[model samples]
Target: MAINFRKGIDSSLDGVTKLVFGAAWDRKAAKQSGFARKLALKSGGKINLGGGQKDIDLDLALILYRDGEPKRIVIGHNMDPVHGAAVHSGDNQTGEGDGDDETITLNLTSLPAWVTEWAVAVFAYKLGTNFDQAQNVSLNVYDASNQGSAVLLDELMPTLGAGATASIIASGKINRDATGNPIDGWTTTLVDKAGRLGSQGDDTAVLAFAKQNAGI
Candidate 1:
């Protein structure tokens, strides 16, 4: 299938049973302050202050949302599954290797009843450097059940600067019929907002952006 994404535009991925959000970045050798590290440990993640493994260069965070609010976040340090539906595949401190440096997988069919959306985002644990230090790895989504087929937006992920710390790549929502009736499946949405997106981002900022643009 052909996949496309536009900044601030809403696309549909309805009836998608399985989805994957994956990314890769060149690791920057830097460390966050002690205070910031403590805060990240205190709260699963950080807001604008930036948090996570304190040593991780970049990470893929899968956020579960209900009614536009973040209920749970899966980061480098906290890789807990959400309702047995979503799982993070360990953190890759460096984007040195090939393929996906990090990944998150979700089974839409197994999500809990209360879970409404899945927002896939990536953040540079280090705020001082942006994607320029990394490759132009466009955050991507794939059909996990279809033999890991790429959805075709490999170049859609913007190469952001050091200031743009976070990027909300895309989302998946429960499906509904034309009559506005609920269905027993889920749909996908391509949200590429790196362009025009400011440098300010964190767990809180990404959640708000996802909910507002999820088209829920």
Candidate 2:
């Protein structure tokens, strides 16, 4: 069975497991459900929340950090970072796709030595209603080898209050042994800091809070 990471919860990640972050919704739901407006949740990584934006776009972001410092970031506007360690499949405004509307791929094994923690966040752009008003909204962590199989957090994402536009639902930290020796992998958890981030345009705000809440 897929592991469920309930709201306000956290879980550890296995080093050997390669993972991907994804999210999607049914655009048609807006028309049929009588709620019409643009809404989507972006799933991306954050190396340094307090750092600066390398580039800006409506798509998801992925970042790497070392010693709590920002290292590399990749977004739709700029998909040329981390070489081949990370890849973003662009944006999905309409949620008409079969599976995930947006996605980010990460190869933990390929991460550099100085890398520390990684975080994923979501934001609502031009929202018509609160998250609760959205239809079929979900974020998930799937296996790289089996994209169809979700290992963690493959369920409905809770909606926030009206006017809230951003959220950092989850994050993972690079693990270290009890002796302070570096381990091959890290653990993940549900930071659930939603409604704190601002509109999609204010992505920088989400980045800053991600560091403290995500523990990455």
Candidate 3:
């Protein structure tokens, strides 16, 4: 399999079957400044709401494929578990933490034999929101097969033009080998793209994105 080394993160998945995909970001820098001031206020100072800055929320999702067809979507908090916890999602509504705000875990070994690919992505869920509204936004994959020694496999911090309206970022995918053995010989490829893939209030957004990514 030819890997897109230049646009993708190349790593040895020789013995890795459990992977953790994480996405994180902070409130826009301008918004954070006001929040910072609120924290630094005197004892009786009134709390500031950052001048009514809009809250930024991002969601992590996995679109699973079976026999080259988009089959299921494992969306954060909304669609929690797929295949009886084979894939788990950790969703954070408020990007208040220091680390990953949203996460999706994939147990490749538990996936069905027909499953072929899993597309990774993150999107700004707020109406009319885009990547330009957040700060330090990143999507990453980690090899978590080890008990407590997970290592970062790869990561990408997506950005946009001054006023681009794209909300979703297709980070990449894990392609099962022709042998159909999810436990081994799977390749992780990065195909970073930022654009609109689905409509607001649509439940099939992730699946639509998945099909488009798979060229189906």
Which digits, one per residue and each the tens of the lDDT, describe model 2 over residues 1-216?
Answer: 244466545455553357777766554222321121211112233222322212112235665666675556555554557766677787655556477777888777776666677766656543343454345656667766454654653654745455555556666677566554566546666666666444344435545555655555
Question: What TM-score would candidate 3 get against the native?
Answer: 0.73
| Model 3 lDDT tens row, 173-214 | 345567765443666655565666466435476577556653
Q: Candidate 1 on 99-168: residue-level lDDT in tens?
A: 7877777777777666767777777645464554455465656667566454533444644655565666
Candidates in order have lDDT scores of 0.62, 0.57, 0.62
Q: Estimate each model's TM-score.
A: 0.66, 0.66, 0.73
lDDT score at residue 60, model 1, on the 0-100 scale = 83
RMSD of each: 11.0, 11.9, 5.3
Ranking by lDDT: 3, 1, 2
Off by over 4 Å in 1: 1-15, 27-56, 126-129, 146-155, 159-162, 175-181, 195-216
Number of the candidate with higher lDDT, 1 or 2: 1
**lDDT (C-alpha) at residue 33 in model 1:** 81
> Total backbone clashes of model 1?
5
Model with the higher TM-score, candidate 2 or 3? 3
Q: What is the TM-score of candidate 2?
A: 0.66
